[model samples]
Structure formats: structure tokens, C-alpha cells
Target: MEFGLWEKYYIEILDDFGFSREGDEESAKLLDEILSTEGCLTLNDLGEIVGFSDKYIVFGAGPSIKEHISMLKENYDLKDYVLVAADGATTAMIEQKIVPDIVATDLDGNIDDILLANLRGANIVIHAHGDNIERIASLTSFFNNVLGTTQAQPIGTLYNFGGFTDGDRAIFLAVALGASEITLAGMDFGDIVTKYSRPNISNALEEADDFKKKKLRYAEKFTNWVAENENVEIINLKE
Candidate 1:
């Protein structure tokens, strides 16, 4: 998607969530300065990978990720599709012995699992936002095949494809990069939170706080819009 078009939705996201655009910009600058894009995967490279498959499967860090993965294992050849894990969902995929083709994270998930995926050749897309500046600074060095992105305004090596949370962003990326057909697995937008929701890889399932639910609502709504508006064929496994 073009930045000109994406900015309109981004403005609304800032207004609805009351997020600070300046803070996001600051984080973006820091990330851009630190990330060495030399010899790394470019947007073109990503396109080749995403477009390699007939379908793209984007997985969210919802509670049902394991079951959905199992269903895929039982009925289909995963090698035929490009698999994307959003943030903490990387843990679920890794646990299932499935290494995602790509991972979109904001340093807010299980860093351990994401790193493992990176080591296993998953292209890592790191997003810069206000809340994760410190986390980004501390952990940026641990990743390989890194690409930077910012929702506010992309600078230098960073680029913005669109969408809010990691899950929706992964879909946006798949569409923008090359995938024409997509599938969403374990993308439940309920009011439940679990160990798989965020960085707490050692915890149990729990109720989502109001703020987390609010964000999920945005992700769900935006994802639905993409399915309807974008030219790609998006099949929501939940439906």
C-alpha cells in the first residue's frame, strides 16, 4: 500500500487510541539509526518469499493457535504456503516445530522464540512504536534478517505497510509485498488473554484487560476491512 493512502487510516488509529505520533516518530528514528540494513533482506526480497507460495497463512497469538496448527499439520502440506507468525504466535509455531517464513513483532513478545525463528531463517520485521523504544534498544542486536517499520512515518531503511497490531500488520505486509491469497488462523478476536497473547510465555490464560481488548478490536476491524477492500482473497479460518 502507498504511504499516502495508509496515513489516512494511521491518523484515525492515533485519534482512536490516543497514541502519540511524536513518540512513534521518535522511536522510528532511533530504530532506523540503529538498524544496519546493509546486506539484509529488502522489500523486494520479502516479496519474492511471500509471493513464492500459492497462499499465505498469517497466524495471530490467540489461544487457539495450537489447535489451528495441528489442523494444518493433519490436513495440509504447509510447505505449499507462506506462514507468518505475529509476535508471540512465533512461540506457538516454534512449539509445533513449524518455523514461520516471516515474523512481525514489536519486541513485545517472547523474544526467545522469535530469536529462535530468526536463527532458523525467519525474516524478522521489527516495528517501532512509543511503548517499545527501550525494548527495541536493548534487544535489537539479537536479530538477523531485520527490517524496520514505523506506523507514524517511515524513515531511512524503515517502511510502513499499514495496520496496527502485529497480526494485522503481517496481513498488510503479505498483501503489499506480493501474496494475492491469504488465510488467517487462530485470529480469534475475543476478550480473552493468555500466555500466548504477549511476552509472558510462562503464564496461563487470563481475561484481557480493557486496553488489550480495545487494541484487539482495532486489529479485528482493520483486518476485516482489508479482507473486504484489498483485492486479495482472504479466508478467515475462524469463519
Candidate 2:
């Protein structure tokens, strides 16, 4: 979608969902800073990192992630592939000593590990939102000064949860990074796993069910968007 259209859609969705659009604005600013930073990697740089011009693997924190890590490791080499980890997956990946090429997070839940990864020479890509603009700005400064420059500079992707689903930023950023093939793992958008903890609400299970349904719907929309806008391929590891 065009930038203007996307922005309008995002505002409408936020109003409908009772979510604040401030976070989206903050995300946009963060992205702007990253893109304008000196010696920083831009979307074009990301495209080159993955080779093939564009291809990526998005790792979600769903229970199914554990099952496919080995398969992904055995089948795909990380030499020139972008690995986008969602939220808390950074911790799990760290435990396995599997450093993601790029980590995406919204400064929620256990953000320290991401900082640690940056210290250890891992490229971090923080997600920015309007509500957390100050925090995101702080992080950008910290990385720029403390992390020390390397061949691979850390990045920040601004996300406006405007008209998109919760995790759609992960998919969109992966594509923006020039991923021609985007594979998904640990995206339990169907709630097919029984061993996982659902987010807490008055009706947690019911909420999870609804969240799963919405995720699936978003995934379908994402697939269609990719097919029409870019020649990117969407592969669902759950199937």
C-alpha cells in the first residue's frame, strides 16, 4: 500500500480498536532517524545482507518454534539470510546460542537480552512505537555510542500498528528488508498448541482463541499483500 493510504488506514484501525495512534507516530520517527543516521544500514543494506536481494525467516515465540529450530538449522545456512525474531524469542534463541541476524522488538518483556546480544556483536533491530518514543530514542543513542561500530550496524524499524494486526510489523519489516522469501515459524496463530501460556485476560483462553483467529486472518492478508506488491513468497512452517 502507499504510505499515505497506509497511514490513513492505520489511524482508522487504531480508532476502531481503541488503541492510541501515538505509538505509531513514534515508530515512524524512530524509523526516520535510523534511515538518516550516518554509517547505519538502510532497507537497501538489509536487502544485501540476505543476499538473493531479498529473503528472510521470521521466528515467532509460539510453541511451535522449538520444534522447527533444528529443522531450520539443518536446512538453512545463516551465511546470508536475515533472521527476524519476534519479542521474547531473543531469550529462547540466546539459550540455544542461535544468534538472530536481526532481532525485532517493541521494548516489551525482557529487553535486556537484546542489549546483551548487541554487546556480543549481534545486529539488533528494535521496533519503535509512539507510546515508547522516548525509550526508543534512548536506545538508539545507547547503541550508537556504547555498542561501538562494526561491519554490521544495528538498526531500528518503526512500526505503526495502524491497520495491521499485532505481529504484522514483523512480516512487513522482513519484506522491507528485501526478503523475497519469508518463512514463518513459531507463529501459532491457530492456537493449536496446548502447552503454551496464553496472554492473561478475564477470559484468557477465549482471548487466545480470538487472538489466534485474528492472527490467521492477518496472515492471509499479509500473504495476499506480498503476492500483489512484491514477488515475495510466504511459507508457513506450521504446516
List, residue by residue over 1-239, the lDDT tens digit for candidate 2.
44555656455556655656555554555655654663355455555554553567777766677777778878878555677776566666676778776666655535677676667655655555555567666666544312111101123433232225324566777666556788887766654422222333344133346655655566556556665776688888887
The sequence of per-residue lDDT tens digits that candidate 1 reaches over residues 29-148 is: 888878854434678877775666758899998877888989999987899999999998998999999999899999888888999999998999999999899987898877888888
Clashes of 1: 0
Off by over 4 Å in 2: 26-40, 48-53, 144-166, 191-220, 227-229
Models, CA RMSD each: 1.7, 6.2
Extract clashing residue pairs from model 1. Answer: none
C-alpha-based local distance difference test score of model 1 = 0.86
Query: Candidate 2, overall lDDT?
Result: 0.57
lDDT of 2 at 168: 52
Which sections of candidate 1 miss by over 4 Å?
Answer: 37-39, 201-203
Question: Which prediction has the highest lDDT against the true structure?
Answer: 1
